[model samples]
Target: MENKNKIYIDAIKKIAGSSKLLKDEPMSRHTTFKAGGTADIYIEAENEETVKKTVDFCRLNNIDYYITGNGSNLLVSDDGFRGLILSTAALKDTLEVNGEYLTCSAGYTLAVAANKAAENGLGGMEFASGIPGSVGGAVFMNAGAYGSEIENILQSVRLLEADGTIRTADACELELSYRSSNIGALSRVILRADFKLKKGDKALISEKMAELNLKRRTKQPLDYPSAGSTFKRPDGYFAGALIEKAGLKGFSIGGAQVSEKHCGFVINKGNATSSDIFNLIKHIQKTVLINSGVELTPEIRLVGKF
Candidate 1:
């Protein structure tokens, strides 16, 4: 709570309501991992305009800020973020549908979007029915499941650049690859996205989503707090298979443990800190490399201090 920080926070509060501004907000309360410390200043901008105003103000003032969506795939440090964290949750309040196409705000969850598409009798997004992340994060990482990724259905994305400009990038321009996208490297704020879909029976689409949801529930370690799959599926080799081969199943470092139910996930057995997970991940990588000669890359993004 420096004088300069208070001044900057006061400026940010004017862009939105006072209730939207939080100081020393607990990071554990925001992320899916249910761990970490706090954010020095957290801004919950209600709409794109507020997000733009807040970001522009920060940029102009030379104040550090990080934009995030959903916080599902992030590991925040125990020391917490020293800068402003602009969350996109408040920006998700709109969903528009036209025939076989759907457009929604970036903060909207993929699961909600998939359900909306199903309600409109739209297909091609059944794989997103169980993803627990926002549209912005999903598109950024080219997230996927069940042999399908967002690139298959994504038409374009409305990205807000750092210089206060908005640009629409097509899927081709994003260079969507296995659990990656070019936009992720650019550090732009995702505003919205258009999804190309197909006309299908609502009942059939619901059935498909239901089947996938069941598969996810049965296989994933839903009982514990985790960032979904901990490692990306390496080319020609599954990360989970390699970890299992390396004998790291149910391996524990502090309270963080490689899930016995599924080796792909690293779960908090309650009270696991950020450092615990980091050590566990490194140990798994080293063991898997020695035993299987394959390196496991983390699917989750690390933020703030370690």
Candidate 2:
């Protein structure tokens, strides 16, 4: 570590607590892919204040930093990150329900939130019951499944802007569409999300959630480590269908393989490196484009450098 970087880290430690600060933290330990190298500095931020403070500090010091929640849809490179990674993984337990609205901290997992909504007799979250990602991540990417997306239920999001100001923006302002959002381009960090739901029978909601989860378990490659659904659905075509048509299902590149169970996923078959996953994704894209004349785009966020 450089002397100047050490000085900056020390300042962060005083505000975020020594236990929250980690040096050379393994990236594999954080992401769902269970691959990659290390991050130079990692901070497990506990609340919105800590996140704002740390982000402001990083920006003011001209230090590169990335904000993450749950690390569910992320892929870091083998060479690792050269900057700070501020994570919201510690804010997973905070949630509140009022009337037809449920508000959760950014780090709260979607599965837990969906279950909690059912417990509170709220509907409209059943589609998210099996999503293995945090609330902030879902809202950031407008994540969805089973013909529903976050834009349908999302009411608003509390964000920390690049200028160090906090504001609650309505969902309509976000321009949510097909696994993309304006939040990233605007350089905003999601602190929390408010979901507007409907009152429904608890039994019916629970039953729906159970059915969806069962389908996910039966179809998805849960036995391996992966960022779910590697490719976005291209216009007029499904990415998985194209890959299958291209004869790339169950294909292997190093320990990274197109899942035998579902062509949509690229799984880490235990000894896979970040490079293996990257190469496999590219190969699938190239093959699918040539064979089907449709380009595939990755849904997972790539971090650091490949």
Candidate 3:
């Protein structure tokens, strides 16, 4: 580590303690893809205050930092990141229900939140039951499955702004669209989110959740390590169908292969490297664009230098 980096690391240890700090932690262990090199520093923040303090410290010192939650939709490079990765995964995972609204911390898993909503006879969260991500990440990307999306139920969120201040903002202010949000552009961190749901039959809600999860298990490549849906659904064209029609399903580049079970996902076949996955994604994009008129765009977030 450089002298300046070490100095910041030592300073951050003082703010968040040595237990919260990890040096040269492997990115493969954090990401769902289970591929990539190590990170210089990884901080598992324990609460909102710790997150704020660390962000403030990094800003003041001009240290590069990236916030992560669950690492479900991330693909780190082989060279790894040279900066700090501040994760909300260790924060207090709490869910509270107040009438029609369900409030949860950023660290809370979407599956758990969906189940909790079903338990309380609240509907609308069933569509998110199978998404393998945290509330913060899901909200950040407007994650959706089986037609319903986070924007439909999201009411408000408590955010840590770029200026190191916390405030609640309405869902409309987020400009939640298809797999996009304004949160990252504004340099804001999601502390917590309030979801507005409707009262429904408890049995029906549970049944809907179970049905969606069943469909996911049958259609998605859940057995292998993948970052779920590799490409975004192009306008008027399904990415999976386009790839399949191009005869690229079950194709392999190194250990990275287009999943036979779901052509949309690029899966790591045991010993795949980050480079393999990256190359496979590009190949898929080029092939799909050549075969069909629609160009495919990656849905997963790339980290570090790829």
Candidate 4:
């Protein structure tokens, strides 16, 4: 490790426990794709306060860092990150309900939140029952499926700004659009969110979740390791249909293949590398543009050295 990293590691060890502060930790073990290299340092924050303090320390010390949650839509390069990866995933089980609203920490999984909503006889969160991400990531990307999005039900969020300040932002202030949000531009980290849902029949909510999950299992390549949809849905066009029409389904470059079951998904067939997945996605984009006359964009987030 470099001198700066060595110093920061030593400093952080004093603040956090050895178990939560890992050196050269594999990113694959934390991601849904199950493909990534080691991170120079993988640190977990117990709560929002720890996140703020850690980031503040890094900023003051000139240490590089990246914040991530759940690692669902991420694809880290083989060389790994040379900076600290501060994760809020340690706050996973923090959730509470108050009347019609369900408030949860950023690290809380979307699926778990949805289940909690259902348990409370709430309806809006049923659409997110199968989303493979956490509340923070979902809000950051305005994650949507089955015609519902986080923006639709979001009321407010507690965020940590770049300048070591914490504040609550309302849904409208977030500037949420289709699969996009202002969080990145503002350099903000979501700490928690309050979702406004309506009372509904418990049985109906459960049924909705079950129905969506069934659709996912039947249509998506859940049997394989993939970062959900490889490309964003183009306006008035479905990416999967376009790829399938281009005859690219089941296409392979190394171990990365266009899923035969779901053309939109690029799956790792046991031995795919980051380069293979990246190249396969680019190939699909070029081919789809040539055949369908519409350009495709990736929805997955890539991290670290390429």
On lDDT, the leading prediction is 3
Worst window of 10 by summed lDDT in candidate 4: 1-10
lDDT, candidate 2, 4-119, per-residue tens: 46678789887686338888999899999999888888998887888888888888887788878878899899988888898876765469899999999988899889988999
lDDT of 4 at 128: 87
lDDT of each: 0.88, 0.89, 0.90, 0.88
**Which lDDT tens digits does candidate 1 get at residues 120-215?**
999999999899999988988899999899999999888788678888877788888888887756767888999999999999999999999999
Clashing pairs in 1: none
* TM-scores, one per candidate: 0.96, 0.97, 0.97, 0.96
Task: Judging by lDDT, tell me the better candidate of 1 and 2.
Answer: 2
Q: Please estimate how well model 2 matches the true structure, expressed as its whole-model Cα lDDT.
A: 0.89
Task: Give me the runs in candidate 1 sitting further than 4 Å from their true place.
Answer: 1-4
> What lDDT tens digits, residue by residue, belong to model 3 across residues 60-134?
877778889999899999888887889887765569899989999998899989988999999999999999999
Candidate 4 collision pairs = none
How many residue pairs clash per model? 0, 0, 0, 0
RMSD of 1: 1.4
